[model samples]
Target: MSEPREQRAARFKAALMKSGARSDTSLYEHLVRLLSRVREEQPQDPVDVLEEMSRELKRGALQQDRGALRDVPATTPGQWLAEQQRALFSHARDEDEDDLVETPLPNLAEVAFFFQQAGVGLGGEEMQKVSLALRQLSDARPLRSCRFWGKVLGTEANYLVAECREAEPPGGAGGEGPGEGGDEDAAKMIVPPSTYKAPPVVPAEERGTGTNSSAYFVCREPGLPWTRLPDVVPAHITAARRIRKLFTGRLDAPVTSYPPFPGAEAEYLRAQIARISSGTQVSPLGFYHLQEEDEEEDEDEEQGTTRGRVEENPDFEPLPVTAMSKSLSAWVHHVPHILTQGRCVWVNPAEKPAAEPDEDEEEEEEPDEPEREEGPALFTPLSEDAEMDRLPPWSSRLSSALVPRFAVAYVRSNLWPGAHAYARGRKFQNVYIGWGVKSDAAFSPALPPDPQREFPGGPEVTEEADPTPQEERALRAAAEDKDETEDETEEDEDTE
Candidate 1:
């Protein structure tokens, strides 16, 4: 029987080899596990067992390949698989398509100018916010008649030609051009070519006769002459009017600043005062690239301060962009508004600006009285919120003057409260509806709780009342004595 089985098995092996079967030893272990499971489930049928083994061997080979390639890079799984994909796509390749790539575009300086113009026109809350920022950043400089432009072109050389009008004569010199006229007319005139004959050349000696001599005519390097644009004052004023509109009718409303509260309030007030006194003119002398300066130290300090409190204080608030603008104007002009009126008070009457008052106006004025000076405290708190509703007449006028120079935009109410919640696990998210920011000069929150006192803990043994008590011999003896006496009395009763 054993000899017959061996002969059958040998014949089967020879048949497998002849049919081009390949050895797959890597999947041998998996094949064995599969055979074991099959043998356990179907112990009697050898034919079924063999069929199951064949099917499991195929599955084992697939699983073994997956396991072997598990650590391979995702880009390419197997050489054979990659080759097959390449073969499929390679069959339909297109050769006629152009390979030329488009070049990236260039940035233009004129675009920045256009944005500046457009931003001025936005003229609303954003304008006021911008004005306030500008006022805070403003500095003094001499009157600048020309705005210098860089990166001009050859054909665009004519743009600066009109700017040469200041050097021209009062009535305008008669040049060879067809339409030369008075100074005003010449300023607006366009010269048309009168003749083809070699143009009547104006000598160098005659160049400054008409429009070239006045200081109003801009001067710059001939090679890169600056292009002069119209003054932005009118645009600035328009934007400022927009800003004024936000606060003019609503003095009682609250405002926010960018830096949040406390520190920001002080910083903003200081910057605002600086802006008012300095004005908006920038000095070309000190102009330097921001990248060239060593700002690391200043930045580090700012970061240190901002990082700590900003995330922790929930009640922190900022000034409104509109208020910052108004504040600057009020301070610069010595105008009294809701905040400024009570703060900057009056400069000494004698120190007042020289004014030639009308006789009738002077007659109506009261005699000079001793001016009250501020005590040790520079500022006193307002009696009530109602007192902040009005501004003295002088403050209104000064703010109006600053209207041409600065614009404010984007007046946010507060840096959303997170400061209190971050350091403490205490959550503070809700903001009061229609709540307004007021000066903290009058009130501030309690100091944070002591850290050590708040979180003390440790393991220690503590005594608790125990209901179980140890037996006492003395107490038991007394109980036994009482029991014996009772028994003796019962015996006497029985005897009676």
Candidate 2:
């Protein structure tokens, strides 16, 4: 038989006490109100209301371990590793007692920015380079650019070893030209310098008087930089737009500038542009001198240069003049598909929805239903909603939970690492966050803070509220009255 509401409440109160909730009357009254509401609305079954309350409290406690649900919970061993890897390689630090430094892995937009910076160019070239590089790198190493491995790869290592490769010669030979009917013929090609020989310079006066410099293309250093979008392009536009967009027209506005981008976004965009611009008749003078550090362990090692073995020769592929030219043709003809392939990864401008396919065609290519990797463990196909649900209600309640309009300076400070971890987990699921450290040890406690005076910004003080002057005065007067009354009572008792 079910107990009376009062009896059930009494049991819940005991459970709460056992679980470490404060036993103050105010808190008790608050819990009682909730219990009354739950009883009035939801009927109890095999599990009594008190039992339900206990279960909920337990869930709440577990949620705290789940980083208050702000953290992306590990779904699989691989994902857990990825989280660990990110945390290990993150640029953020923990300043609070909680010690959870949220460090998200670099994202595609950021990846694109790197590509753009590499002068691989954005659009078609970027797509091709990113995909080809990743595929090649994966073949070389199981998960070269996986989020966990991203930091290890570094900008130079990723570019040299994991980022996309240029079209190569047939026979997998570095300098040898392609043979007829070779893969090199189909391989995507970039512009060659010979195509754009500078015309014999005419007299300075003969130059057109109406100097109309096209903002579309600017001269750059040879290599990817020449052909690809500038790292400064996105920055320029972003800065320009930000300056215009966030303009309150107030001269004394706080933080008068759009925050500087870490150049990741620009790199990703450049890569994207390169990918989209692939196969186009690019000018070789359009060089993007991709700066790569010598990642070679010995003199024989060239960062991106692969070592051949019996199964896979360490030789480089060569491209033919004709094959390189054909890349331009393919780029022009397949422009639409190439442009839209994976531009969704861009951040400066968020991706627009893909146009609806024709009814008959839609039947031919049904949108692939999301498939969760089947396993004994709980593995859910990720979604914005699911990710949001993983966080505490307050954290996820903001319009832009990922990027809020304004955050507490403390939350913002704490969020840097958390954001890093969050973005990494969401974007790159395969990489470990702290790959070097054991998963359990990734978030281990750090050195204790030194003793210091209590202040507005102390870590110990979470939420601070100021009391009214009247309230402060009342407390002071009450203390004084109590002391005086105690003295008078003591004197009367002594006389008796």
Candidate 3:
């Protein structure tokens, strides 16, 4: 006996209807792939085969979702897994953050708590999320130090930036140091060019406010990956100053605006972070002192730059927060202004090298010469706050400029728009909250004052001249007489 096709179809339908099961897209795709494999193998036990396939698919997806731990060598499995666990968003704790090393991390929770008084603080829940994100970042990467850079709000979404000091790359900055070369035959003898066509400025100390001083990472959401932003090139910084647009929150989004930018949103964001930090990041007067001379030869040699760095002042006496909050000059800008050519230090290429004066002669004339200019102080005073649309550019106050213990200085910058900073004693915190926009010189579009009118006599002043009845009659009589005189003169000319 043989079964007909119609009979087989009827039997399958009856069984499917009785089971009352619905197949979704995920299940359908899985089954389709499984059936293809089964048909190829002509499996003996389909049930056992399906179970094995399911396990394999699950394992592959797990690896894709939770990334493979970075920087883990072929070591103990348990230990590596533990490290992966630490490098997750949930590793953050309620207490303050601390590194196993002595480097003290900025406490975001406390900053949020203190800055709330100024009305610019990111709320408690958001700050907690940021803490978790930062914790995961520090654990994931080989970081020497990391801190919360401010939040930049975007139209579609927002970016929470993390500033980090990364471990130096292998082979050092120049690729391989002199010692790394194998032998005389293997190594190539090289020397720097005697001079450059356009010689670069002497770069400032690496640890201070140099170009791309620290690494910056941005993330839209706490669960999302922390993307290391591209470095800010000079051209990008110059362009960013001219154009002002809100971040789209997409790293690869094209910048379709005027004075076309080179890269994408990542480049634009990096330039903005540099500008904001330079303008609003400040500290108390003596909080940071400039290093007059190089101290350690090892660090100077490693970085390959002369030392004109900024260091923490260990012996700084606490300034009264009440007095400090009364004026803007009490604080000083720690970051250097990005010059027009997009550099911190300017270089004069035309000047030739000069011979050094004798030590004895220099000492003899030291008392006679005028005081020298120390190329823009490592820390300069914050400029006077200006007024915008009648409102002050900066609002400074203390929780109570009276109480010493609770007195914390809070200054909100209107120039950079939503930048805020708070200082108590030694510890200080700064954060930004609005869209990344620097305030324009004028709030509304300015048209020239209708241009001054061409009036020479200051202004044309006219008064309504009134006439009495007598004056009106006299004017009418004069008009009639003038008409008669004109008629007589015309007749005389015709007769002649």
Candidate 4:
């Protein structure tokens, strides 16, 4: 015969506590070990023992909370047991619900565009499911707000300009101030659209021919439009400003180019490339397109005479063609890949490498091997798969120009202390406007007029030559026909 269930449960509970099983996993292992020992000691059914132990534990719990249990009316044993089982199951279901994590949704427009471009077919139901998933993902994440500031250049129709420099504290002195600066500083910073000037022209001799060459003389001829943004701008703008600030004094600083607008710069580049490849023109806010038109001459005299005409049409401009020189094609193509796969390295300029000691100094120094000390690690070691899982998505990393906007925000908040405070207190805006074309002299001359072929005694006169025998015979026949036609017309008039 088996011992009383209460006695067995009390002994088991004591053993469980003694085993030091604090976590659920350890508790389960301990319970399994205890059951194995009980099986070895007796030939009794393990199921019956387990059931009895459960009942004993439940009774003990009820006894511990006897005061609370007494408040409820007593019921038949069968009904009470049923109610307890139902409650236990319901609690377990709730726990399961809490543990479940929902999947994120994708952007529907992007998804549709991708599928359409890839030539992939999707059924109606499948598309509906994808759209639903995208909705769920979008709903899960909050939207981020962005701000931009720069100048508009060229004819409003066909123009190319850069919107560099995010809004920053107005003054060069970095300190806390009256959040609002003087009106004069604000006036200087906020350049109106109509007043923005075209990019200043540096002579070719001064500008040099290097792609990474620094501007020797920035043409400051004021006429083009300029825009100034207030402090506390959008995340992307803050990132752009921070990056530009980082390279302030370094002449050989790395070139970090960002898109004029917000969001994934790679996506923008890809779309631009696709549009240009398809022969469809794209004109962003301040860029112009150069189109070639053919002019036709009088067809009767010169049947196939046509001349090539190159014209600038502000209304239709492709970004790649207008924004930068053709030499930047490689860089443009490489930008998307870097944004997706590259990681940023933060190096402190103040830190320098230690110099090597002389041979005499090395001989005088004492040799010592430091003893290794053992200590608990602060961070848990992660497997390769886990580390890969922790990495951000490509889209997220490349969502903004140069570096991700979030990374920039992090740098500002952590590395550049007081930057946030300074930005918040300042009322004035900082804007950097760059134009594509400075002056006619800055650019290479257009194709020179085709060299005219010189003939001896100037251009030959084809009409000066006398008519051939065949031509003369035809002319005489035409004259005789005209005379006959006139005579017939006169005869008809007389008969009438």
List clash counts for every candidate, in order.
36, 83, 0, 15
The TM-scores, one per candidate, come to 0.15, 0.14, 0.56, 0.15
Model 1 global lDDT (CA atoms, 0 to 1): 0.28
Model 3 has a clash total of: 0
Tell how far residue 45 is off in model 4, in angstroms: 26
Give the residue spans of candidate 2 off by over 4 A: 1-81, 84-163, 166-496
Model 2 Cα lDDT, one tens digit per residue, 112-181: 4333322322355434443333332333332212221111112211222122222221222111111223
RMSD of each: 34.8, 36.3, 19.7, 35.4
Using TM-score as the measure, which candidate wins? Answer: 3
Runs of candidate 3 with Cα error greater than 4 angstroms are 1-104, 169-209, 295-306, 348-376, 383-393, 401-405, 442-496
| lDDT tens per residue, model 3, 1-496 | 8999999998875554452133222444555666777788777888877889766654554434122444546778556545554544443465455454344356777877778765666778767877777877876788777888788888777898888878763321211211222677534668565432443332222332355677889888665678988666566776788687889888888887776776689888988888888778888878888775646756755543335667789998768888678887878887776666555544332343577877776453223332222234456666553466776667777876356568688787878888888888887877877788898765342233455455344335655679999999999999999999999999999999
State the weakest 10-residue window (summed lDDT) of model 3: 171-180
Q: In angstroms, give how far residue 184 of model 2 lies from its true place.
A: 29
lDDT of 4 by residue, 1-496 (tens): 9899999999887666653322223354546755765666673677668766645544443334335535676698667545543422222345454334332322334433333322322434434433443232223333221111112232222111111221221333211122223577766886646533332121111111111011111111112222121111122322332222111212122334432323232222212222111111111222222232334335412422122222333453333311221122211110101111110111122333477877776554433433322221111111111112243111101112443222111001111111110000111111212221111222232344577666446346545779999999999999999999999999999999
Worst 10 residues of 2 by lDDT: 206-215
Model 2 has an lDDT value of 0.29
